[model samples]
Structures are given as structure tokens and as C-alpha cells.
Target: MVDLLKPYLDLRDAEVETDFGIDDPVVYGSRAAIESIFTNLIVNSLRAFAQDYSSGRLESAEVCFRKIIIRTKKLGDRVIITFSDSGPGIREISIDDIWIVGRSTTPKGSGLGLCIVRDTVEDMGGAIRAEAHGELGGAEFTIELPLRN
Candidate 1:
């Protein structure tokens, strides 16, 4: 997942930190499906940073400190993966609407990223949620998937 998002992260000048808490954590899903889910989430974070930068929400000095943290943990028979960023967060009123197709908070967005993410997660028998307040002060996406037997 990190490799797939390297270019975008480099382009956005964003810092990424990853922590895999468990050894060889495995989930019940295809590689492509998992990749797609993470790709969309990372892309969305990058987009949020870009938008914030363009709107002057992030100053020049703070640009270098832009952070995105990806953490994975094993919770019993489930795996929890979290993607958190330091970019602008989703509005409280819009959090529930984020997964709706054609509903975008940014002008340049197609509004389908989260929609697809939710669909793919459900297809894999997993669940996903968005949190308005993240440790990084931006949007946080938590995905829970059943561990592969």
C-alpha cells in the first residue's frame, strides 16, 4: 500500500508513518481489493492536503510538517487499519455524507472515492467509518476486516 502511494505522497510533499503492530497480519480479502481500498483512502488524504494548501489553510512553514499516519493492529480475530492525516478535516455535518456518491466537499472532487471505498469494504465483509477528529487533526478512516483463518 505504501509503495502504491509513494508517487502521490512525494508529489504532495506529505510525510507518511506506518506501524504494523502484528507480525504477518492477514485479512480475508483479495490483494487487489485491499489495494483499491487503501489507494482511495490515501488519495483522498492527499487531495485534502492539496485543497488545504491551495486555500491557504496550511502555511509555507507547516507544509513540511504535513503528516499522514497509517497504523494497523490485530484485535482478536479482526484487523483494524487506520489512516489519519494532518490536513483539513471533514465538517461534522458532512461526515455522514462522505460516502454518498456525487457528494464532495471539494470543488474538484468527483465525490466517488469514499463511495467506492465503502462498497469495496462491504463486499469484503469488512466495515469502515470516518472520524471528524483525528489525532493528526484531520480526517481519520478506520477499516475493520476479519482476519483470515
Candidate 2:
């Protein structure tokens, strides 16, 4: 995942930290589809940081503090993965709209990113949700997938 997002992370000078709570976490799903879900989430996070930077919410000097964290844990028969960032968190009112097919907070966004993510997750029998103020102080996406036995 880091390799796939290196370009965007480098472009924004963002820091990404990954943690796996378990020795190995396995999920029952298509590899490509699962990759796509995380790809969109990370891209969206980078864009959020960019928006905050341009709007002066993130000062030029503080740009180095921009960060994203991805963590995974296994609970019983499920695997929970979370992706969070240090940017302006989502507003309560905008949370519902985020999953809509044609809604976007970014200017050049197609608005289909999260929609595709949700669809792909559901198709794989997984569930996903968003949090306004995650540990990272920005949007947090939590995905739960069944463990592959």
C-alpha cells in the first residue's frame, strides 16, 4: 500500500504510518478490489491535506506534520482496518453526503471515489464507516472484513 501511494504522499510531503496489530491479517476478498478501496481512501486523505494547506488551515511550516495512519487488527472472525489522517475533519452534516455517488468536497473530484469504495467493500461482504474526528484529528475510515480461513 505504501508503494502504491508513494507518489501522492511524496507530492504532498505527507507522512504515512502503518501498523498491523496481529502477526498476519487475512480477509476473504478480491485483492484488486481491496486494494482499490484503500487506494481511494488514501488519495482522498492527501487531497484533504492539500485543501487544508491551501486554505491556510495548515501553515507552511506545519506542512511537515501532515500525516496519515493505517492500522489493522484481527478480532475473532473479522479484520478491522482503519485509515486516518491529520487534516480538517469532516463536518457532521457532510458525513452522509460523502458516500453519495456525485458528492465531493474537493474541487476536481469525480465524487465516485468513496462510492466505489463502499460498493467494492459491500460486494466482498465487508462493512465500512466514517468518523469525523479520528485519533489523527481528521476523517477516519474503518473497514471490517470477514477473515479468510
Of the candidates shown, which would achieve the greatest TM-score relative to the real structure? 1
- Full-model lDDT, candidate 1: 0.85
**Predicted candidate 2 versus true structure: per-residue lDDT over 1-149, tens digit per residue:** 67887987888889899997976666777779878998999889888888888887667898777899999998889899999999887863488898987788776777899999999989888999999889989999999988888
- In candidate 1, position 58 carries an lDDT of 69
Q: How many backbone clashes does candidate 1 have?
A: 0
Model 1, range 1-149, lDDT digits (tens) per residue? 78877887888788889998876777777888888888888888888888888888768887776788999999989989899998888963478889988888677788899999999989888999998879999999999988888
- The Cα error of candidate 1 at residue 114, in Å, is 0.5
Q: What is the lDDT of residue 22 in candidate 1?
A: 74
**Residue pairs in collision within model 1:** none
Candidate 2: the clashing residue pairs are: none
